[model samples]
Target: MLELTTEQVAALAEIDAKRFVEGVRADLCKDDPKLVDDTTFSSRLWRAFKAAREVGIERDENLVAFLRVEAYAPSFYEQPAIRAWLTRPGRSADQRFHDYLRVVRWHIEHPKFQGGLNNGGSGSAGNRGGSASTWSGLGARWRGFIGRGSGGGSG
Candidate 1:
C-alpha cells in the first residue's frame, strides 16, 4: 500500500491542471488560429478553466464545451438565465451542462432567439454580424462532437 501527503497530492493536481490547460490551449488554437495572435488568449482560457471547475464541470468534453461558450459569450455565466440554469437544484454539473447545450441548440434553431444575444441586447457579450450563422455552426460542431461516444477525458 502507498500513501501520499496532502502537499504532494496538491502538487500533483496542479501539474495535472497545467497539462490540461496546455492541451486545451493547443486544441483551441488548432481549431482557430486567431487565438494564437490574441495576447489575452491564455489568460481567458485559464479563466474559463477556473470557471468550469468552480461549476463542477470536470469532464474534459464538458470543459471544452464551456470554453467554447466562453469564447463566444465572455459573460455567459453572468447571464441571468444562464445563472439560473446553473444554480438549478437537483442536478449534477454534467446534467446542467447538457441542459445548457439543449438550450443553446434550441435558441440556435429558433428564429426568434437569434438577434438578442448577438446584438448586445441580451446578456451576451455581443460580437459583430453573422452571429446567428456562427452559433449555428457551433451547434452543429457540438452535435458532432457529442455524438462521437463518451470516451473524452484529459488527454
Candidate 2:
C-alpha cells in the first residue's frame, strides 16, 4: 500500500475512472501509432490500479475483480497480446502480473502521469479541441510537478 499524500488521494478521487484509464492507454499508444493495437485492457486496468496505488489503493484483487466485471474493451483484435488479455479469463497469473508491472512502469514514465506537467509548449491548457473538463487534471499533472517542487503533483 503506497502512502499517498492527501492531495494525491484528492487527485485520484477526482479522476473519472474510465477516462483516466482510457487516457492512460491513449498516451501509451501515441508513439508507435500502432500502439493502440499493441496495448491491452489488462494493461490499462493495471495502470489504473497502480496509479490509484500511488494515491493509496490497497487491494488489486478487488481491482481485478472490478476490471473483470466493469472493463469496457474497445475492439483491439489486431493486437494479439491485447486481444488475448481481454477475451481470455484463464491466462497464466504470471502473465497478468507482468502486465501489471508493465502498466505501473508505463504510468510512472508517462508524461501525463508526471503530475500535470507540460510538454515543450506543444499544447496550451484549456485550449485544445479535446474536452477540458475531462483531461485537464491529467494534462496539468506533469506541469504541476515541474512548475512546483520536485515532489510536485496534482490531478
Candidate 3:
C-alpha cells in the first residue's frame, strides 16, 4: 500500500473513481505518444494505478482485480505473462496484487520509461540550443525507447 499524507488523502477523496479513470485516460492519450505502440495493457494500467496511489488511495487486491477485469482485459495473445500470472492459482490475491504494483512501479520509475520526458525536460530541451548531433542522440534514444522504427526495439 502507498503511504499518503493528509493532503494526499483529501485530494484523493475529492475525485471519485470515475473521474480518476477519465483523468488517467486523458493524460495517457494526450501526453503519451507511445500509447498506441505499447505492447501491453500494463503500461496504461500502471499510469492509472500510480495516479491513484499518488492521491493516497490505498492499493489492494480488489483494486487490482477491478483494473484487470474492467480496465485492462489483457489478452494472452499479446501479453502472455499476465495470462500465465492470472492462471496461476497458488498465490494469494494480496501477494499477486503487491507483486503487480511492485513490477509496475519499477518500470515506471525507470528514467527511460515512457519516453525520455519521464526523466526531464520537454524532450525538446536538447533541441533548443544543444548541438544538432546532441539533439539527434536524444531523439534516437527516445525513438528507440518508444519503438519507433526499424532500429527501435522493445525495452
Please provide TM-scores, in order, for all candidate models, with all chains considered together. Answer: 0.67, 0.23, 0.29
Per-residue lDDT tens digits for candidate 2, residues 28-101, read 44522443454465465655455434333345453443232223322212235533553456654435544644
State residue 72's C-alpha deviation in candidate 2, in Å. 21
Q: Report every candidate's CA lDDT.
A: 0.65, 0.42, 0.44
Can you tell me which runs of candidate 1 are displaced by over 4 Å? 112-155
Which one is best on lDDT?
1
Best by TM-score: 1
Which regions of candidate 2 deviate over 4 angstroms? 1-15, 46-51, 54-155
Rank by lDDT, highest first.
1, 3, 2
Task: Select the stronger candidate by lDDT from 1 and 2.
Answer: 1
User: What tens digits encode model 1's per-residue C-alpha lDDT throughout 7-35?
Assistant: 99999997898788878777767766666
Error of 3 at 34 (Å): 15
How does model 3 fare in lDDT?
Answer: 0.44
- Candidate 1 lDDT (Cα, 0 to 1): 0.65
